[model samples]
Target: MDVACAFPTTLDTPDNIAMAESLGYVRAWVYDTPQQSPDVWMTLALAAQRTERIGLGPGVLVPSLRHPMTNAAATATLAALAPGRVSVAFGTGFSGRRAMGYGAISWSFMDAYITAYRGLLRGETVEWEGKRMRMLHPAGHAPARPVDVPVLVGALGPMGNEVARKHADGLYVTFQPPEFMREYSWVPYLAWGTVLGEGETPDSEHARLAGGPGWALAYHGAYEFGGPAAVLDLPGGEQWLAVVERSPAEERHLAVHSGHCVELNEADQAAWDAGGHSILTDVTISGTRDQVRRKLDDLAAHGVTEIVFQPCGPDTRTELERFLDAAGSHLKPA
Candidate 1:
């Protein structure tokens, strides 16, 4: 399977993107939570200027965050700078929206937004929000219209999957088994974890720093979707429900997602201290080099075309370098 790298929403990410290019990752995708990090397209433009071979795009954009025309133009801008190296994905809001005190957008809304976005890119006057609009850029203003960057949909269930199958060129999913979608040739599975150091355990300080975010995200996502019951079962997950429940309901959203993928906030830290370590090693793809290589092969066998690994920690450079060493060289950069 092709190996790709996904990044947290941090401005310093372009430097890491460059590292990925030199190390031969097929694509470099960045998180698009505007409240948490730099603008997605701006970050991508910086990455475009720094790297030539690797692909770049937002891993998944929340439709509610911006207008279709805005994203259409941004897509064109990235296409102009990176040309064929650009690919974009849209989602019904995961972190980007919840952190802002909202839930996922409806698939029907997503269907219409995607239609308008794609239509705008084709240089067509598309009707959206009761008005018609089209890209009217001159040559050199933005890549000439009909910019053909691949579009992916961040989806999980049948409704979202149907939208992806019908309205997008690819699929972007998080925390799912490697399952092939027959309708599309592109499937990007979002994953996390670290390569264990010699004699290292999953609960080691390095492993927690490198992969704790993935496990914590489980609690945050579960609480958001199904409440405390959803999260109480995971390894240190029981601690998070009570912690968030103690907060005012209106502010609970903020409490759940604070620190996000960057570090463990107070509540998340409590959970981790309680027993969150095993969740990281258990759910995330953590192991030694040979073990990780075999897991990657298993991922490919199960229909994962691309493994979008998101590394965390203060020393992102080291984490990324180690991941590349484990991914081997078969996955060439775009």
Candidate 2:
């Protein structure tokens, strides 16, 4: 399996991506949480300039955040910088929309948006909002049309997988690689958690910092999909619900999704303290070097072509380095 590193759109993205390139990572993907991090395309552009071979793009672009014309331009601009190294993926919003008190978009909307977006990239006029639109960049204005980069869809259910099969070149998934997705030759899996050090336990300070944000996502996800009662069953779910309940009903989402995928906020810390550490060690990729390697092998066996790791917390570089070392053998494909 190919190994890649993803970033949380931190200021250190360019440098971290450079580090990944040097360490033999095949690609560097940055998240698209506008409210939390820098502009995903801008951060990716900077990263592109800093590295030569590693691929760069948003891990998963939330379509609701921008007009297709805007994304087409941004994708074209990055294609100009990185050429064949550019790959873009679209997904129903999670952190990007939830943090803004919005909800995920529908597959139908995404299909239409992508149709117009790709039409523009292919130098064809497409209709949007009942008007004709095309990438009108003149000579030296942008990469000559037909940007022709790979398109992927991040999915969690059959609807998304079906849409991907129809519209995207590949699939991007987080958990449970479905049998239907096996027909696609390539699939990318985004992994969470830290590689535990020798003799270190799951509750170690470093593990918590590096992987707690992902663990806390459980609370956000459970509550978002199901309700307070749904979240009350996870490790520390009861306390986490209590913490979220502290906020006013109208804007409680602000509290629930505060530290999403980047850091652990006060509510998350409360959950962590109330026995949520198990969630980290249990569901995330936190394990010894050997154990992490086995996990990658299992994912590869299940048809995951690429394993993308996003390092979180304070010392992200160190976290990346540790994961790199832990994924020693799996870094290269068979």
Candidate 3:
């Protein structure tokens, strides 16, 4: 399996991308939550300038946040800067939109958006807002026609998976077990929070704290999809539901931003802690080095082609280095 690092698009993102490249990570995925981090495309442009071998792109850009034309142009520009080292993943808005007090875009919108975006990237004119448009750039200034960029779709449900299979090169799923992917056929790119410390097992407190935010994200996703009732079946789901129940209806959507591993505030951290530590063991790959290696092997054997590791905690660089030390041998050449 190939390893990728997902960053929060902070000021240090380019630095981290360069470090990850040197450490043998295959890709660097920048998050697109504009309210929380720097501009994702600008960060990616810096990453492209800093790193030579690693792939760089938005882990999943929200289609609703920008016009398909804008996304196509920005991606084409990045592809020009990085040449063959660019790939993009699109998704219905999550933190990027919800943080702005909106819900995810409809699947139909995403399907149409991907179609048009792909067409525009290939230097073909695509109909947009009742008019046809194409990226206009001089031959030497932009990537040549038929830009070879792989587009993936970030999805969590059956409808999203279907859209990805139909319109995208692959599927980017979060917190899904390998067995789930084996049952549903698609090129799988799995994203999980990874926490590795000396002598710490998957159930350790340190591990739980490191991986808890990812579980919290799953809880939030479940609630968004099916209301509080949908998440009741998950471990510690009742607690998350209770928290949501206590919030006023007007403020509930903000809960979607509660469990981000990269920007957990005190309140969010407390809420995640209340969800119980074992929730981390269920949703994340957290353990000692040998245990993490075993988990990586299991994921690869079950059909995961890429693992995008979201390293959490205050010292991200340390966490990333430890994660690479444990699993870097499994990284396939880009």
Candidate 4:
């Protein structure tokens, strides 16, 4: 399987992309949460100038955040800079919209947006708000006529998967195991956190701490949108819900959006402790190197083509290097 690196649009993103390229990662996907990170397109522009071999683009840019015309233009501009290396994935906003106190964009809106955006990319005129529009003066350096950029769709639910199956080149999924790939035949790109070490087992405390932040993200997503019943099936769902129940109702939102890593407040930490190793194993790639290889083998067996590794913790670069040391051999060159 090919490996990609997903980065928050922090100031150091270009450097991170360069480093990942040097370490043999095939792609660098930047996040599009404007409230929490830099503009993804701008960050990717810097990445294009900084790295030569790695694929570069937004991991999943939210369609609701920009007009179809704006997205089409920006994508064309990026393709001018990086050509075949540029690809885009569209998603119904989650953190990007939630952080703004809004909900996900309706699928109807996304459906229309994708149709228009894809048509625009192909140098065809598309009907927009009320009028027809097209890229009148395409960049000479951009990929020709049928702008060969790959379009991926981020999906979690059945409806979203249907949208992807109908309109996109592939699907980007998170927190799903290999079995999911078998069910969905689209070219699959899986993203998950990685916290493997030389000798620590999946059940080791060190492994749990390394992987806990990612597990917390999954937990928070279910807690915020799916409610108590949605979380009940998870390993420590009951205990996690109880801790949230104890918190001031207003402050619960703050707890869920706490900084990227797993450094939760005392109460949150207690809940995390309650989840134990099973929680970490569920959402992250954690275990000894050999164990992680087995997991990768399983994913490959089930048809996962690309694996995007999301490195967490205070020292993200170090965490990334650790992952590279353990799995770099599996990364095919771009």
Candidate 5:
């Protein structure tokens, strides 16, 4: 099975990225969170110079947060520096307007961003704000290792996935099963599977990890195409947002943290299975290596091309050591 380790969205450090490479991770994925974390592109650029072969990119950059022109420039620069190692995943970001101080845009905006971004990558000159611009350094201009930079769309629902299929080179999903992915044609569907650390208790590691920044996934389902307002149409959506908005920080975090485990329940499993989602749907690869190997094996059986492991909490080095030790036998050679 192919595996990669995630950089904590808010608490990422160079030491953690370095450790992941030493532990045999093929790709070191980072996140693009505006409110509390360092900028994803700059961090990845620094990380690019620090590591040799590991892949790097924002697990997601909210399309709504910046113009596609800016994204195009930044990604192009990274591709130039890192060559074939950069993969850009664009998506809708959600937390709360309070945290980021901005409202969400519509799905139509997402379509425009992808179309424009891809066009630029192919050396097509696109018109923006009454001006025509193309990639400054076209793909064929330099022999600096032909760029294999893939633009991954952070898809959460069928609609988003379908749209992604029409434009993106690959699809990056969070907390969704392989069965659902089977319906799509995107070749590489990378799932954000979190491998909870081992501790004295079954959920101790998970709890500590949950309280950290990546906790947004627990309350909110995957990446928000927009803010809470973006998916108000989803089932139990408005009520869920209401809870997130009104509850105190601690209370809201507890609610968000618990949502992830709900996906593991029998009813949820039956619903997901009935919907044709493969058994590799649960994104958390917690517990011992023996246990995680079962999940990894199941994903391979279901045709998962890559499993992106999002590590959380403070001690990334310790967690990474445990993960590599347990799953080392299953990994492909570096």
Candidate 6:
């Protein structure tokens, strides 16, 4: 597996990047949220300077939140700084800002935003407000020279997956079986694996530390909205987001399976069974190094090219350190 450390947009401190580099992690992915977390591009640039080989990017930034031309410019600039090791992923609402006291935005707008953004990235002038807008200075100038940072789109279901397949260089997948993913033939798949903690007691603590409450809210958003994919291209989707916001936190969060940050005995021992670890293992990648290796190998068998660790709990540094220790042996460069 191509193991990379994920930094929450909320908690990514400079020290975290330094530690990830020392431990041999290849990338640092931060969340992108205007109200909840730091700016993804700026944070990534700072991290890029701190580490030599580790890739930097947003786990997923919503295009609706910013003009695509602007987003492309920012990402291109980061690529200029980091050269070969910059990437980004885009997604729809995972955090319902309306739930946290804000107006909701629609998915249709997001689609248009991506279309416009891609236009700018390719150096085509986009028609805007009875006018045209283009990249001020595209990174690639000569015909032989081209900006090559990989762009990924988060795909939780069919709609978004299709979009990712059509528009993005790859797909950012989460909480879905590799078998299911294969049916779609998604190339360059990046699986999201979150680890809360380690050791015998990791399961329970990982649950609490993962802020079960916050994820519960996210779950409610997905479920009520007919999975994250269902909302894509849905007209007035923010109306549904508003509903989830009104619902109580406890009502929305319901565990899909046992264990927390790490794996259960059954999950580790019988991961290859029909159900295996896929469904139940939705939210995390906790377990011993060997256990994680087995799970990642399973994903690889089904075509997951990269595995990005989702950092949970209060002390992200501690969680990342443990992950490095457990999974480092398997992350040897191919």
Model 5 poorest ten-residue lDDT run: 261-270
Can you list the residue pairs that collide in candidate 3? Answer: none
lDDT leaderboard ranking: 2, 1, 3, 4, 5, 6
lDDT: which candidate is best?
2
Count steric clashes of candidate 2: 0
Poorly placed runs, candidate 4 (over 4 Å): 138-146, 177-188, 198-210, 232-254, 260-268, 275-278
Model 5 root-mean-square deviation: 7.7
List runs of model 1 lying over 4 Å from the truth: 178-183
Please provide, for model 1 over 139-172, each residue's C-alpha lDDT reduced to its tens digit, 9 standing for 90 to 100: 8898877888899998878898889888888888
Best-to-worst ranking by TM-score:
2, 1, 3, 4, 5, 6
Comparing 1 with 6 on TM-score, the higher-scoring candidate is 1
Cα shift from native, residue 212, model 5 (Å): 7.3
lDDT of each: 0.83, 0.86, 0.75, 0.73, 0.58, 0.57
Question: Which sections of candidate 3 miss by over 4 Å?
Answer: 177-188, 198-209, 230-246, 265-267, 272-275
- TM-scores for all candidates: the values are 0.95, 0.97, 0.87, 0.85, 0.72, 0.69
What lDDT does model 5 reach?
A: 0.58
State how far residue 77 of model 5 sits from its true place (Å).
1.2
Q: After superposition, how far is residue 114 of candidate 4 from its true place, in Å?
A: 0.7
Q: What's model 1's lDDT at 183?
A: 55
Inter-residue clash pairs, candidate 4:
none
Best by TM-score: 2
**Candidate 2 lDDT over residue span 1-334, tens digit each:** 7888888888888998998888778998889999889999999999889989998889899998999999999999999999889999998998888888888999889889989999999999999989998899998889998889999999778888778988888888875567766777778888888888789877789878888887777788888888898888887887878888889988898999887887887788887888889767667877888888888888888788888998877887778888888888777732
The CA root-mean-square deviation of candidate 4, after full C-alpha superposition on the true structure, stands at 3.2
Per-residue CA lDDT of model 6 for 1-334, tens digit only, reads: 5677666554445568767777777777776666556677887878778778877888777766676766787877787778778787887745424323333445555556777777776777787546788766623632212345677777666666666666777677655543445544433333333443344443354544443322332233444456535532233334433443344565332121222222222222232132222232343454555666667777778777666766555666666666666665457662
